[model samples]
Each structure stands twice: as structure tokens, then as C-alpha cells.
Target: MKLVVRRSVCFQGHQIPDQEAACQQSYGPDLEYRDLMRVTAIVICAALAGCQAVPGEGPLASAINEDAGRSPAEIGRVNAAVFDIVDVDNHTARLVSDYVSTALKRRFGIGGGPGRAVIGIGDQLKVTIFEAGADGLFSTNDSKQATIDVVVQPDGTAAIPYVGTVRFAGRTLEQARQEILASLKSKAVEPDVIIGMGDTPSRSVTVAGAVNRSAQIPLNLSGEQITDVIAKAGGPTSQPYESYVTLVRGKKTGTALLKSIVENPSENIYVQPGDQIFVTRDPRTFTLLGAVKSNSRIEFGANDLNLLEAVALGRGGNDETVNAKGYFLFRYEDPEVVLGLLGQRRFDELARKGMQPDKDGRYPIVYRFDMSHADSLLVGQTFPVKSRDVIYASRHPAVDLTKFLRVIGAPVGIAVQGAAISNNLSD
Candidate 1:
């Protein structure tokens, strides 16, 4: 329906006497006065209408639906190389929510029991020799026992007073003592030996990056796990979930979140000799885009973040602009996880529709969750927000109506003010 506005005429602050005759009277003698006012109203209306056109284009989901590929009709819809939109449901939420980080646990077995505590090359050891007779090698007439500090050489041997060079590397402290006793028995007078380990350079795990103190933590005879060494070096400087611990043992390396190690004890593996640990802060975050109140990148924080929590973090959707049914989460899903979840037949059908995998073997996917229904809300509560995920709140169809009314309102406001003035000169 065309917009119609009616209003009573007033002069300054008071209603004009004989309002009908006063409105009919001319404002000026200029023959061009009434025509100028009428032309101005038409110009303002056209400008406002043109301005609303871009913003009034329908909901974002409509645009995606228009360009959709013929992916498996059952496996959901795909927009080809751009993205794939899947309306999340209860069954899909159950399967996708099961996705957890097993990066460290899968590669390195969780059952990392106590490791060997053998003396390595370059280890420091204090050896003491005791003899029944005073006049003997490594002992004076005044003292029965003689103590010497020695380092395990790179060649896996240590030099002694009478034993020449003894190999201590790969031997337990007690075992090394026995070997030394045998060597001293042949030289020193009735000698007994004792060997003790000290702080060593080779048998230590180096802890650095995002820790209170970056240092080399010495391994004791008992055992030192990943957490033990991190605590010794003054723990992670950031939140446990935000902290990632990378363990480099020899040529192999494995990384796990500090939260994972604390929550799952089996993940806290024993540190080996010469192991290097790196503690880095990597906050898990997702981008909230499109018709949200505030477009931003928010952290997942110390716990798992769900779709509902993420929407709150994005300051919820703009009610005037966003659709109740159009929130989409964009992610490059691992083809293996998705294919396994979808089963081979459905995925094969999707591939046949020309929706190919990317260079990283990942499929570009968009998961749409309608917030209008109670079931969708419950399903969204279980759906997880992953790191680097993008959430786009699509525009509402009413946004076009809202903008169109705005354009109409501009012309209406002009008509209400000029109705009397324009009617007078037209006659």
C-alpha cells in the first residue's frame, strides 16, 4: 500500500484561524514556489530508496543456496570451492562433538612408564675409595678413604687414580661401583668403593618458552615426568589450556596442551635424558563475523567453547539484521574425520559432484544451526567451536523490509511537513 500521512495545519505555535482558507492562501507571489517544493520531495524519496538497495538484499543463506552444487542430497549441501553448509541436527552434533585433540596421545603412546636412570656420557660422579691399609693408592697414611670428582668423558669412560680409565656410561651407580671395586682390588690395598651421582649436563630436560623460569631440569634416579620438570622450572606462565608443551626426544617430537596432560594423567609422559621441552602460549580462538553485533575474534578460553557460548561472545546476533535460522560456522574439516563420520558412500557421492578436497586434504565446510527452534538450541549446545573457526550470522529477510520502510519513511516525513504548503500553491 502507498504511504499516506495527514496532519492539521498550524501557524508558528498556534492553529491558524480559518485553517482551510489559510492553507489555500499563497506563501509568496512567485509562480515557481509550489513547483519547487513538490520537486524537492520527489528528489529526497528517490535518493533514500536507492541508498537502501545494497543493504536490503535478502538473507545471506539465500545467496549460498542460489549457488549450491549437487553434493549428496542426503550428506548435505555444498557451495563447491567456496564452502559447504550443513544444517546441524542431534545426530550430527553427537558425532562432531566427539572430535578431540589426540595429536600427542595418538603418536606417542600414553603409557610412558618410568624411564631408565643410567649414567650417560658427560655425567658428573663423585667416587670415594676406602682401604684397610693407610699406605695405598688414592689414600694417605692419615686417611683411610679418598674422594675424587670425575666427569664421564664423551668416550663413555672416566679417569681414576689407580684404575686408569673406567667406563661408567650406561651403568647404574651401584653397578659402576662394583666395576670400580674390582679394578681397585687388583691395585689398591683391600679397597672398598662408593659412587654417587651429581648434577649432570647430559641427563637433563631443557624447559623453555612461556615458563616462569627457562632452565635445565635434572633427572633424578626415581623418574621425572613432563609435568614434574615443568613444575621444577616454575610451571607454565599462561593458563593450562592456553599452554602447549612440545617434547623433543632425540629426533622425535610430540606436542600436547598442558590442560590435556593435567586432565589426563596418562598423557604426562616420563622425560628421557636429553629431552628438550618447549612451553608456548597458543590461545584457541574463533572469528565471529557477518551480522553479529560486534565482529571479533574470541578465545575459546580454558574450557571447551560451544556454539551457544560463542554466539554470546560475539555479543549475540543483531536482532534487526540477523535471521533466527541463519548462523553458519565455517571450517576446513579434515577429510578423514568427515569422511569417516559421513561414511564412504556419502562422501564418494559428494566427491562425484565435483566437491574436491583441498591441498591439505581438508574439505571446506559450513555448519548452519537454526536458533529459532528448541531442538536446534540443544544441538548447538553440544556442537563445539574449534580453533580458527569462523561464525557468520546471516541477515534476516525482514532486514530488507526494514530498510525499505526506512526509505519510505524519508519521503513520508517530507510529505507530512509540506502537505498544507504544497496543496495551497497547486490550486
Candidate 2:
């Protein structure tokens, strides 16, 4: 089939002047410069306006799968809900990272550090009685002192000779010793008493789960930290980042990453007797999605991962399509933590807008960090990436326009060229 190319295209029912003086003969060659400019502007504006309506190339599969990939048992983890997006900066990054509601030192400390060791049930105690002179009731002339074994019963009371049964479960060794000496003075010659620790089986920290050897490490007067107890149990069975140390003391339970305890000395808190130390393996990971080179779950190493390093682990965003400014990380943030990032003013604004944390005391939030800026790049290098966080790199807006232009640009260019040639011929 023969193809025909129309040199003179229709524009709002107007005829173009051909080389044979087509427009000059019919509608007169005066198309008016102002009218011409109006038409030109409309054409240019129409092309520019189409940029907004242009769509991206394709919806690629995410590095992190959604509900479709989750097992029925675990599918609840991919619940989709409306969330807030906050802009991240150096101040926000630092505060949100370091913020912890109950730090080890704050929760377990007494008098700026772990308090003096107190006698507890299963703590073995021995009392030594010293007489001023010769034997009275028990001490002979040959030996002026006598040692007696003391046992703390499950009822929180210890049975001792002369003293009978006294509450000693929570008392210090010195206090118990003083009580014994006072009780003995009434029955014997001027007496003094000293208390010393013996085999203490129940006065120990229980170290269980993901360790080389699960055991109950005995606590001494010197005291032992969580790390010390874990080390004694043959250390964690996993990497520091992958290991979790949970301390259950009575009704309170505190958990910290093994990596954090190693890096921050303050987090390596002292373990009290009867404290349950559970060394569990919980791998720290982040989901890399959107325009990244490799969209997959990335596991943390021995150290905490910075934003830049996390991105690097995903091979950063796809070079051509990634919008550097659209880099975002999704995480469930605490309310107080939101305050740190938003500041009082912005936080109040959100509160006024009826924004609140969920039942879990966490705000479903995403932090946007514009890597397009040199300063943000620097900040991202040091900004910490939390475990289970979701990182997304959006496609640039210009990418859509580029694709749209590639398909329609040639026709627009040809039309403009033909119009110019017709105008020159009319002149």
C-alpha cells in the first residue's frame, strides 16, 4: 500500500500557505503574529500538560513480597494500613536512634548501679560465733568460737541456732550476721558473729536458649553482667546482631540486642540472682523494595547497619530510574520517638489533626530521606537502619515524562517544523 504524508495539517479549521500560495489566495497571508503566538503557546502547553498524565514504564515486582508471598500462618504480618510519612534529618535520625523508653541502667539500677547483693532463697549461709572469754553454752575453752550452718527455707525464713527462725530471704549477709550475734549474746558470754556465703545453688542467674550451653550461672558478691552470664553459658549460639538477650527479673522483662550490649557498655547490665537470661536468636533484617538493584530482605552483620550501608547492601537504587529524593524507610515508631523526630510544634499539629499511636503504642510511620542532597547523603551514611524496617526507592517523575516524550515527541516536532515552513512561505 502507498503511504501519503500530509505537509499541510489541519489546525482548528485553518489552511496552511503552501509553496503555491494556498493560504494567500484564500484566507489572506496575514495570520497575525499574536494569533500565531497564541496557537504556538497552546501547542507547547498541551505537550507540557501531558507530562503530568504520563505514567511510569512498568510496575515491577517488589524486592519484598506482600501478602501474596506470605504463608497463611504468617500472613498477618503483612497487614496494610494507613501510615504517616515524616521527613528525616540529622536531628531526627540521632534522637529516634538513641531513644529507648526503658534502658537497662534505668530499669535495673539502684543507687546509680546494681545495688549490694542481698541474701535470697537457696543462698547458703554460715554463722561464726565468737565469745569474749571461755566456753559458755556451746564454745569450749580449747576453741573460743563455733561455726553453725544456716539454711534459708522456701518460706523466706532462715533457721539458725539460738536465733530460731528469722526472715532472711531478702536480708544482706551483714544484717543477718548482726541479728545472729544479738540473739547469741543473751544465751552465752559476750558474743560476736560473722556471716559468710557457702554453696549457693538457687542464688544464680538462669541462662537458657540459643547459647552454646544453657546453664544457671551462680552469682557471687562481685556480681555478673548479662554478657558475663552469657559468656559463662558458652556465649550466644548466633552472631551478636542475630542474638537477643532477654532478662526476666520477677514481673519485669527487658530485652536488648546482643550487638547493642557488646557495643554499648551501659547496655551490658548487671544480672541479679534468680534473673532469667534467655539468649534467643532473632536475626536483624530489613526489607529492600522499590527501585533498588536487588529487592530482598537484608540481614545485619555483627554491627548495626547505617542507612547508607543498608542501601549499599541492596546495591543502592536502580541508577537510571530511582528517584534519589524519594528514598523512604517504613517502621513502627514509638510516640515519644515521634516527638523526638517531629519536635513539640509538629507533634502538636499532628495531635490536633487527630493522629495517635495504635494499640501497640507505636505510630505506623515512614521516614523520607532525600539522598539527592549532599547533606542527606552524609546523614544517611551515619543514620541507623532499624531491624525489620522497609526501605523503598521511588521512580523519578522525569522518568515517566521521558518515556511519554519518546513516544510522542517526534510527531510534535514534525508538526511544529511543518507549521514554521508554511508561515515562511506565507511571508
Best by TM-score: 2
TM-score of each: 0.68, 0.71
Model 2 agreement with the true structure over 1-427: per-residue lDDT tens digits: 1111122323345543323333222223665656555544444333334444456433312212232223334434333443456678887777777775445555566324566888877667787888877857657879888888777788978777677887887788888877777787789888888888897876688999999999878887878778888999999888888888888889977777788788877787777777898988988999998877998998877466899999899888899778666787878777778766667786665555445567556766677787868899778866788888988887654454344434443224423433443223222
Writing each residue's lDDT as its tens digit, candidate 1 over 311-403 gives: 998789988667767788878887756775567786776677777677646787778787889898789889988778988887754344334
What overall lDDT goes with each candidate model?
0.72, 0.68
At residue 217, give the lDDT of candidate 2: 88
Candidate 1 displacement at residue 156 in angstroms: 2.0
Best by lDDT: 1
Error of 1 at 186 (Å): 4.5
Clashing residue pairs in candidate 1 are none
